[model samples]
Target chain A: MGEDFAFWLAYLTNGKHLAFYASFRFTILAAVFGALLALVFGLLGAMARNSRFAPLRWLGTIYIMMVRGIPDVLFFLFFPLAFEQSVEWALSLSVCSAEARAGSAWPPCPAANLFFSTTEYLILACVSLGIIFGAFTANVIHGAMRAVPRGQLEAGRAYGMSEFQVLTRIHVRQMWIYALPGLSNVWLLLIKATSLLSLLQINDIVWWAGQLGSPNFLPQAGLVHGDWRWAYYTVLFVFYIFVTLGSEQVFRRLTAWARRGMPLEA
Target chain B: MGLLEAIWTDIQLLAFPALFNIYFAASSLPIGFGLAVLLALGKNSRNPVVSRLSSAYIYAFRGSPLFIQFFMFYSIMLALNPIWWRPMGIAWFAMSPLFIGPLALVMNTTAYTAEIFYGALRTVPKGELEAARAFGMSRLQVFRTVTWPNMIRVAWPAYTNEVTFLFHATALVYFTLPVIGNQKDIMNKATELFERDFNVFLHFSVAGLYFLVITMAIFFVFGLVYARMMRHMPKERQPHRPRLRFGPKYIR
Candidate 1:
């Protein structure tokens, strides 16, 4: 047992483990940024769906409806490559045109030469997470907004508050209370979805686990590891279970906190 | 002419896989629903062991993400018998991708839908059950007449959503499963487009459109169900009560 402990401890301090820990940071950054982006998108979507303008409402409704139709994995795979190429293309045209005219720099600016580096790839991955999660969050928030009573808004208007004021004060604040459960589930799903980042070659923990456990690691060959990628994945499973379980407890507490002092209303 | 030929080929490629997907979604739904109901009944049974086992099954499946679940089953099945499936006691026909892929999908759906049914069963009206008992119906008869109808009606909307959700979620199988039906599955073909033409926008946009159409069809069917259910329901019971706050007490 002690030897096993020593083995793991030694492994934990290496560059792979550093990358693994960094993956958690990336996951956190993705989650926080994704949540913020989703919230913005959700708000815009919900408001537009509720709006009087036909085209705006249609656009928002279509976005949410279409997003709900497709599996999230496609979005994850599609967005990064597409976005990268689009960005690169735009940059190439602008940059190459300027550089071509100026005749400057060692590497001639060309369309084929333009490519997103690793950091840009990571950023694109997060943006993909944000886009996919934003659509889900939109559906959740849209439902929560609908869940809020029309009477609340009418009462606000009865008190001479404008539509904007009613929305800001009554709707936005109360939507959180109603939306918390669904949003929490979405957030948990987002956490699980982050594991798919390894497929993007983003140097996530799962990627490292795949690397460290593969038989190709000749240096670490004499260790007790075999085709234990599954074991490493099992560790991820446990980590996710813990993350979700812990977050659920927090969500329940938050719900209680949010519901306090409400007039015994449903 | 070239563009027309390409479009025709794309449609031909998509035709079989799309049909297979439709069949997959339709079949798994009933299987999942039946499994869920049985599990729910088990959970509600007087026997503690039965209840506990059902609880464990639900928790284990629900506790983990579906991707991992799919991978584990796919790998383990491949590992255990490279040539034969022990369960069927027959040669697995290792080359045939159809068997395990759909099986994995159905198993995952069953695990999820079972939970949903269990939840709906818990919310079955107590007063109606008591009323049915007053009518002197036997257990099985009461279940047939009173319980099942009401339960189905009450659970229809949710069950419909689950069907749609599972259909949407089937897109995940592409990473592991080989496409059947001339590689017709829309996402699989769309993915091929990504690799072949590298036209990310065009392929995904088409895939997105296919998904939209399928989702609409699902919604339309469910909407009809909703309408029919509403028509049969008592006029006074049409309005839905606001969902109760169950977090604080029940969560722990």
Candidate 2:
């Protein structure tokens, strides 16, 4: 039994398994940066939707409706590809001759073609994650903004706070209480979306799991193991469940903190 | 005129692909809905083991991403193929994405839908249940007359959202499952067209348009059902009957 335990330990700590462990960082990084971007985009979107300016409101409305209507996987795949093509299109205009531009192939010329490394792909994934969840966050924040009592804003005005001050201090500050639940929901979604980081060619945990779990056969040593993909994927399935559970606990505390000393009288 | 013609052609090409998506959702939803009702009742069951099992199942599925779920289940089914599926003489059907895709989707939508139904079950108006019991109705009769109606009414709006998201999730099927021959869904076909001409904007926009139009169609049909459900209520108190404007939570 002791020998068996040692063999299992050695097997798990092999180079590939260690790399699988390291690949988790990409998932965490995407979630963190993606969440921050989503918050920024959400605040802007909700504010625009609530804007006094007609065009801005229309822009926000269109943004929310359009993004929310489509499945996230589409945008997740589209944005990076679109961004690359747009850059290439601009590059072709500057570098390629007019005749070259008339060609049917992509990039117009070889010189204008761009390849993204893992870092760029990860960044693109983050941005796409932001755009998708940002719409969700905007909807949540917009509703929460309306849920804020008018009397609170009126009190800020009565106290001589400027319009911006009233918003930043009273309205937006208190909006957290209502928005926390929805934002947490978005966070759950955003983290789950981090699984798609591999689709952009970022070597994330999901990619590693698929690679490591496939059956291995060595020419010299013979069969290593049959397919263990189910085991690896089960680990991932549980990993996400834990992430969700952890986020819920943290959001619970955040909601409590947001509501602290605010008084039920409001 | 050129751009319009290209778009019209692309739309025509995508229409066939779009049916694959519609088939995935249409095939899975009825089974998902039925199982969801049972799972919801299981969660709400008086038996502790049943309740715990149902809760754990819901929590696990709900907490995880559907993308991973698809990959996980597909791989597991593959791993089981040699031992379990192939020997059973049904691997041809069991191993196909047509079978596995909706199977995974059923597992997923069941969780989300059951959660909604469970919430509705909880909010089924205790007074009404008691009133029904006091009238000497049996449990099954109480369920049919009082509990079931209240549950459907309370759950319908959320269920509509679940259905839309389920439809949206059909996009993920081809991503994880192996495509047979030319059978492709919206995203797959769009990617293929993009690879051909490199017109990322045109193809993707048309694809996105398909999803958006189908989502609205789902809402329109569900809203009609919702309106019918709430017909007994006073006109003004009917919550405006699911107006087409983006109220909230279109695609969860």
Off by over 4 Å in 1: A1-18, A95-114, A143-166, A216-224, B1-8, B23-27, B46-49, B82-97, B131-138, B177-184, B222-252
DockQ of each: 0.25, 0.67
Candidate 2 regions exceeding 4 Å error are A264-266, B243-252
What is the alpha-carbon RMSD of candidate 2 to the true structure? 1.7
How does residue A208 of candidate 2 score in lDDT?
A: 93
Error of 2 at A175 (Å): 1.9
Specify the highest-TM-score model's number: 2
Model 2 over residues A1-266: C-alpha lDDT tens digits? Answer: 99999989998999999999999999999999999999999999998988899999999988877776788899999999999999999998999999999877788999999999999999999999899888888888999999999999999999999999999999998888899988988898888889888889888999999998999898997987899999999999999999989999999998888888888765
The TM-scores of all predictions, comma-separated, are 0.81, 0.97
DockQ score for model 2: 0.67
Chain B of candidate 1 vs. true chain B, TM? 0.82
| Per-residue lDDT of A99 in model 2 | 94
lDDT (tens digit, per residue) of candidate 1 on B119-195: 77777889989888999989998888877777777666666666666776667666655555564466777877677
